[model samples]
Target: MRYTSAIGVTTAITAGLTACGGPASNGDGAQESGGGASGTIEAGLSYPLSTGFDPMITSGATPYAANMHIFEGLVDLDPATLVARPALATGMPKKINATTYRATLREGATFHDGSAVTADDVVFSFERVLDAKNASLMAQFVPFLDTVKAVDTSTVEFRLKYAFALFPSRISVVRIVPKKIVGADAKAFDAKPVGSGPYRFVSAVREDKIVMEKYEKYNGPHPAKAQKMVWHLMSDPSARVSALQSGRVQAIEDVPYIDMKGFTGKNKVESVQSFGLLFLMFNCKDKRFADKRVRQALHYALDTEKLIKTALLGNAEPATGYVPATHPDYSKAATVYTHDVAKAKKLLADAGVKDLSFTLMLTDTGWVKDIAPLIKESWAAAGIDAKLDIAQSPAQYAKVDKGTFDVLAAPGDPSVFGNDADLLLRWFYYGFWPEKRYGWTGSSAYKKTRSLLDRAASAADENKRKELWSQVTDLVAEEAALYPVLHRKLPTAWTTDTLTGFEPLPTTGLSFVDVGRA
Candidate 1:
């Protein structure tokens, strides 16, 4: 990562009361980033596999905060404001055509190396994601972009195949990576990064920690107050919590599901709710999975109630729908799966399946390890012996796109999912992961799901959109393409209440931007 600094604003929104209970747009253009998060606080982040601190390979919840130091987009969504405002771009995208748009470059923006942030830089960044050679994780994030071109020094345009209502939100996530940000010649830049954000990269000590200092050029209202922020890589959630207790660190993240209760306001420990879904994704085109009965059986075999009780310890809400069971559009009809071994067996037998077996890819980090074992046990309890196929993340995610695996045990964080099912549908049922039903197995069921996604993404009416999503959700649950497990509250168990600003988000990983220590 090339260490660079440039002054720019991520969307700053006006705060409103509606955002209190959950994630909502802030009505105020600029509000206090909350509490006195102006000091250094050692924080913990459980990165998804292989997300090497590099934007291209990086995954999970880091980009919103971590990547803010290395790179940023022309605009960012102020979760509170819910407005897509200028960060890298000077303002909102300039709509140039029915299927195309343009964005003006920010004024006086320069990278850490002091190079001007030009239209070429923006185009280069977009090209990096589109280049199939790089195999960037961001590819899955924006599978629909047909192409991106820099029209001039001050303008960049996007040509899309379809009109995405949340196109701006999608743009909000593509952090601007300086040219040569990755690959063989990327050594120098990777060691340090240059970006137009509020922070500057100071040092990255391998797997131990990455440090950054606040940018003096920052013009935003709530500039980073701390002298420096540090992210320590800790694997064991308990180990991380102990560090917090011992004062080795101010905060720890990816709190174990069972560990949530240990935190309370008495200790100044707060548990915020995040938009995340634990699910069992099935590759529909695979021969073993061609049988809907087999897929449906996989869904029925899970003892989610016991999994939450014994494994999750009330840390999560047993998933019953397509999106997080808590999302506004989630439907009751979507919450279909329950532990019915008889039903699972019947489904399997009906599909003429016996001596059934499949590989469950997992990872050491994230829910793959903790929850995978429970799921494996749950599956075993139903007499389906499954093998564990584990890989280092976010690379493991790449396999999902190819449609190579049988069953994928993963969670859909809203950060990646957006506020809608757009990303989910793209990566799962409707898109090409494992295999698209575009071929032999392709059927009306596939069309129905894809149509739901298309309608959901294009819907202009909010109420109608909500109803459409409810139907989309119920349809997926009924199909059991990807078994939705539970909705989770952001879990953070700490040793003390020294740090603040740990609002539960719709994504994964940990961040230090709005977090400060007493």
Candidate 2:
């Protein structure tokens, strides 16, 4: 990819990755120019918080950065194959044993600086995730870490604490960093990133945007053709859509559900099948939710049909389980939440509950507020009185983390997990608490659920593991640890509808590398 500046010259910022470096390019046919055409595509991203612009605490921002030009892992999933393909890695590593594997580098692949990507760089990147100080939310998934040994300048090997079938895919999220520049503070890397991705960090103009110029000498499987990508930070959904339409911005993520249909006439819209699960979470510790009958009754009271039709504003899909319906293990019925006021009332009456009062803490952004009042009314009809507590950005997370409220209408898109229900139950469905971070611990259900999860994890046979996991899933559903609600779709758009190579990232969102000039 090459570029020459054909338009206005605003500012140019360049940073280096741990392994690779060289003279950065910008625009078409120009040195220090980024890839792609001159036409601007202002992208609008929404978040409760800035994700600190850092990976350690950036639960929401990381995905956007991952998509933009800021980061890259050793390998990336191929859109066409949905298989891990070499990005920084020279070639795919062959498993040497149950817990060991090795791979080589492409020899000349370097950070944006031109420093060659080597085995040591890969090792350093993986180890960083395990650092206790980082407490990467990603740590919960990739836990079995022994060591990343650099066999040689180009070759790296992974020695795991235990055998994992999905190790390669897991590495897809471990964005490699230059061990040299990371300094004592990992948080510092956020402001000054050293990544080998197509884009390099320029300057994070606080509260506005993060700018990146293209690397002129990127030697990867699929580097960005665009010279630069400008990520505009805007939290308002309506404003975002307006910006895109009015040409203030070229692209926006998570278009309002209702406006999706209206955009069909002119704008391009793409929906990627996602691994995300957006569901209502029950406070397992809540007295009313503690009863199985009461939980089931509450589930029955939710009219998913009405919610999807009206409350969701058209950006909704019926959820079967924690995993998206498209996921292979998602075998449950999506029709679990039927509208049955009579049945719901009877179950609540039998549970000996007079009236349930709890606050539904949901985000104020997007369609949440649009739906809160409706859901409150649904529960009220079932003899459950609920109040609405809406918060924005950090305040929402603070409350949820502290467990300061009850009956959270939480929704999330956990990156793709292994085909088992272990991570699903352990990190999410089990409910969250202050000290527990994310687990069923401190709850009455912890001991029993954890034991079953252990058995499921340790089971060697594939069929046996599925059976155990199936039992665990059913058990959690029955316990109402988190009421299964709906699966979310990753709304995306391409330069053209005929654009080829676009594929869904295994982690939940869409990958842009697969896209090409139409």
Candidate 3:
């Protein structure tokens, strides 16, 4: 998709908000102002454009947030509720057999380039993702997927390697892309994506902003309700809050926990329970964290309740298991680590380790940054010295993936793909995140966990799958190589007077799929 007009503005709207104590437009032209009866919707995103918008491999916060509007999978996650709903597909795929399924595409669905979205595009999308050379992050989720083929003009068939029950839901990993446009220039396509969604890709500035306008020719269940959208990449928490307060942006995400109560009247704030969690991953290769007992000791030492109340402002719940208590498939793990300083000391003593000193690597996410000191304090109380090495997620993850860090404390939410136990479990344990990333594959525990997860995925019976999942959960909890400390509630602030159909997402980032300016 080709776009014109380079509208530039300052980083933040500080002056206008300082002049007036309430919501008032900064009048920074169309560049920063948005959301009236017939105005563009400017959203203050909490992340910069770190990764380019390639649907298959894009994982960066800003790019992934933008792709939610610019592309649609055969099945798409509902913005408000993360439930899988039909997007490009006419409806949910029909199960033909244990290994085969068919999806009928919605007719007249065209890419932003005005080319018809054919079954060929669907087949190509999945094939590209399935190809090993592309290094798609979605490849691991579809290990069961044997092949995808275009049976007809409007129908696509999926052949699984085994009997996988979550086939319908798992297909959302691959978003459909135009074959001609992408095939011609893959690099250019990544920079500027073209897909059949409500919003068309206009232009994107690396760390400044991303611009998109409603695709008038779009035909889908959740069509764009606004004329245009501009996502201001405000990585700073104060800048985001200022943008919303100044009326320079209609909505803002990652609302600070302390500031939630101050939002009143026309400025609304809501903290929706999200599957997003502050996870702790240990490098199994490190002799220090190699012992499961030491890992368990560290978890037991953490005062999770205190952390949530003080660090997170009670906008989170201690992780009981892999899935939160709110989840439908929630199962309390057999091993529950409930803050016991005495138990932690005893475990460390039993393991024959004294005064543990290790460097803790963390990302620069605002909430995570807030909780980092608390974590160190918890460790200090437990007679452990944890030196902090704070850096951005990409940099921190580079250290994590290379086994350069002792322990990694970062935030992740894969529930946007699917909320199922298998999908959620596989995200950390099954993919490159486990083997190449954290070096957890060497252990017999990893082998057993993988075996149990595989059996669970293939098990036809729901009860059997649950049992297998629980078994894997117990084993992982016992291993303690990686686990969640708490599942956080995503806080979002929006102007109630100017935006309609605006809802806080249970996942990270905001969605304007069906939202409009009042």
Best candidate, TM-score-wise? 3
Cα displacement (angstroms), candidate 3, residue 296, comes to 0.4
lDDT of 1 at 470: 73
Which ranking of candidates, highest lDDT first?
3, 1, 2
Tens-digit lDDT track for model 2 on 82-164? 45677777666678987888877776777765777778877877777777666555566666667888898988888878776
TM-score of each: 0.78, 0.83, 0.92
Model 3 has a clash total of: 0
Q: How accurate locally, in lDDT, is each candidate?
A: 0.61, 0.58, 0.82
Model 3 local distance difference test score: 0.82
By how many angstroms RMSD does model 3 differ from the true structure? 6.5
Residue-by-residue lDDT tens digits, candidate 1, 1-518:
00110001111111110111212212111232433334554666654122234555444354335665556687765543234566888677877765688898877776655667778878887778778777665666676588888887878989987766667667775777666444335534544556767666765543456566666665443356554566776767787766666566656767766555566553435545555667776766677887778888988898888767766666677766665555555567644788899999999999999888989886445554667777888889788999998766444455654556778776555344245556654555654432441131366666787778778776657776677767767776676766567776666544444545544434555544444444
- Name the TM-score of candidate 2: 0.83
Off by over 4 Å in 2: 1-40, 62-64, 78-83, 264-266, 333-335, 416-426, 429-439, 442-445, 452-465, 493-511, 514-518
- Which should have the higher TM-score, number 1 or number 2? 2
